[model samples]
Target: MSKWNPEQDGTLYRMMQEVVASAGGSVRGVLWYQGCSDCNPDEAPTYMSRFRAMVDRWREDCGSERLPFLTVQLNRYTAPNPTPEADACWGAVREQQRRAAREIPHVAVVPALDCPLSDEIHNSPAGNLLIGERLARAALSEVYGRPVHCRAPEIAAARLTSPDPAAAEPTIEPTIELTFDYVAGYLLHTGSLERVFTAEDDAGLIPVKQCEIVGPRTIKLTLTRAVRGESRLHGAYERNPVAHLPLDSDTYMPLLGFYGFPISGAQYDENR
Candidate 1:
């Protein structure tokens, strides 16, 4: 989600950085599975590049130089569509993910076809839970020495304040102009209770904000700071069937900034 542009871009990276900083950086892994609704066949192939770009951005933003990325292959049991156009191109999408796993470091793919589902066409209810669990397992496997789970949140519209030229720091204050986009479905903000940051051998997390479905396929969230930081950004959002959709190839593309940073923090934050 973004404020100036609804499309996934650098602005969203800034927001995530702020959330991480406030919650304390050096946090646990990042689980991502957006694509189907966002990426089609023609351009889905580029997801390999986008995924690599996203990995670099995550490392920079979270202040972790080697943060791990866990991804999933496209596996929809639609009984094979007859026509070419009707096909969602799950194969090409899967290939993109496979390529990413092979090309990118700290990258691993979680198999989905093996999982049971009622129907791939509209598998919302049980599918959502399955995705979350699979994400958690993959994350744990990659990070090693700890338990991990999806920090799924409400898909909130992106909101931002007018750029304050006078201010030196990036603008984090609330704004009236909110850019609406696909907010997530499962997890909202981290949570009320603060948990120990010792979940991962060397990871930290904290629940900071939450969001819900507000429009056709978007969500909005109000962010708060999570100081203590948990091992997993611990918190469970009220269940929603269609909370997270497969992202587009562009979803992982980084919107670089003036000096090549989508987000600007103190030099101290950089080494933290």
Candidate 2:
């Protein structure tokens, strides 16, 4: 049994105040490792709002509005659930944490999606080390303004290519070309690249026949057929995703988790 209520009664917040007060009410930054307790279905939905409130309150207490707040996105962990819905709870909380970096300013989320687990709920020492290094790298680049390689590749654009219209029936299969940001070197994969990505439209996940790196930062995904309507490219977006892509730099930082982009409906032309 524990006497301290970290979330319910502001125990951790008060402790933060004590530390800030002892430091004369000013600090350089803050590191947060929380939200695991809130991953339950009953509590996960409110995490983003509650997180925002806590950050705001901490800023007020520490006397800085735009202070850098670095947080660790929860590492992957789950019991074997035969049902897809059983996984949504943790996935929701993880996504909410990821959104904080995008929605808020001067904040960063250290992604840990690729880290191997020691048990059902614990990240191994190596995994923890990787997470820590990522945090430091983010602080250096985002907070200190150093020119460092810390960002994961993000989807920039996707286009659907079809066979020449002059063909009798245009029987050639269509391909989706994907472009990405932060292209310092080639994208690497241990096995088939198709295993790393998914193309989904309203019809659900479209099977990818092949994924070939056409350019240093671009990949061509050959689909089983041409698609219509809006589609999406999800890279490293799975609850558990392939973890290795290191840019050619001083520190070959791996791609962070959960990258996604929309495929515009305009890309598909029936006239083709």
Candidate 3:
């Protein structure tokens, strides 16, 4: 959310209702990746309860008893967490994710314990992207009645080495940018026109607003500028937090909700 505090449970409930109508049986599948925000020993016990509630609501919306739902069992690389409560909570959540797939007919869990974690809470772009795409493929293969091709990422845990092997290295900007790519040209936007962004420097493929590839390589996004009544030239969605407040276009942009921190795909990163 824009801000975090207590009452997150209620917030999740409301969010579930909001998403259930559209994502219920109408959609092919649901990909849920969450729970790090509520890690606790007691929280673990309720993870399944909450997840089950959400799934039930989802199925009800479909007017059916089941929907293809895929989940990600998050990583623990960042935090060598010694806290028992936190570990217990995560264990419970992971169990719920895994069990849902096993117990439910159309559910699945994508493994992510080997990936890098952000401060031990969030997942890295490379890992996050793969999780999403894999979920999509799973749904396409199972629910949508299509034979989907899965591009699994080949990633290995890396240990940085220096002259001393223990010394800290200088800071460098991350060159790896993540986004959705297709083998064809031009993406389509569903709603009102947002500004079009042409990459200036190291900026790579950008997916913003509703406009799919309006230009050959250029992406059209509904611009959201922090400064009121100004156009956004910098196309980086996750560039800065304060940068995306006043959106220039409609709020129904599906890709907008996930602008920057995109799910990693296997095309770019391979172990060949």
Candidate 4:
């Protein structure tokens, strides 16, 4: 998203160059804060390359390839769209930003997906404080190696409870088991555990029969029906996901955004 078109109006870029050239030239890093417009469905597809290119161009202009660059992931919004798929463009942009941070060295992303918005677009003052704290933590950890815990909690492993081969006609379907990394305390739920997560396959969103936290970091999600084929698991992905336990680290930093994990039931891998 931009206030001025770069092709038709080079005014902003020219002004930026002039300012960079005229200043004492002591700039160390760049803080970027523009992408709201790119959340549109028409503009989201090309946002990654465009944003990456701009970062490269800016680095070249500033005479540094390894210059530290920090960016914020798009926060959550309650748009008119009801389905997560239809409302996924903004999330797509955020995913792109996260991917860039992972692929490009010396780059970091501050997640704002959990911040509450005052309006349709802008975050509330409290939300901004959370974002600012996250950004500060990212800078301190990524740039200064201060050992701050900045990463959000992510799914570390998943498993499907296999039905007993010798059992008679079973009354219950199999369940999906998930484990997470960076869990501070025990995983808590806001309401029902079923409200905090989702299970789906090609057939579409499957209703969750039951959800039980097996341990502090492991959870079992039972589906109404068995998965037909390859399926996916998601947590806090909805536009207005059921607020659950405040996932925090031992340092008390809250987990942000949504998380996805694959359940194969064959083995549990911690590398994801």
Task: State the weakest 10-residue window (summed lDDT) of model 2.
Answer: 1-10
Off by over 4 Å in 1: 1-8, 77-82, 85-88, 114-125, 145-272
- TM-score of predicted structure 1: 0.43
Tens digits of lDDT, candidate 3, 1-272: 11111134456545555675666525555676776664565565676666776677667665677667777655452444355344445545655555566577777665554344455456778867756666777677667768564322111111111122243872221122213322122233443433322111123332233433433223423212111111112221211111122121221112221111222222211112
Estimated TM-score per prediction? 0.43, 0.77, 0.45, 0.77
* C-alpha RMSD values across all candidates: 22.0, 4.2, 17.1, 5.0
User: What are the per-model numbers of colliding residue pairs?
Assistant: 25, 0, 10, 0
Pairs of residues clashing in candidate 3: 129-263, 129-264, 130-264, 187-212, 187-213, 188-212, 189-210, 189-211, 189-212, 209-222
Q: What local distance difference test score does each model get? A: 0.40, 0.66, 0.42, 0.66
- When summed lDDT is taken over every stretch of 10 residues in candidate 4, the lowest stretch is 263-272
lDDT of 2 by residue, 1-272 (tens): 01123345776566766877897876899877676677666877777887787777667666889989888777666555424343445556666777788798888876676677898778899988888888898899889999876665545677777656698777556688877666556665545666566677766667778888777777788876666666776555444444443232333444444433566534553445
What is the model-wide C-alpha lDDT for candidate 4? 0.66
Ordered list by TM-score, greatest first: 4, 2, 3, 1
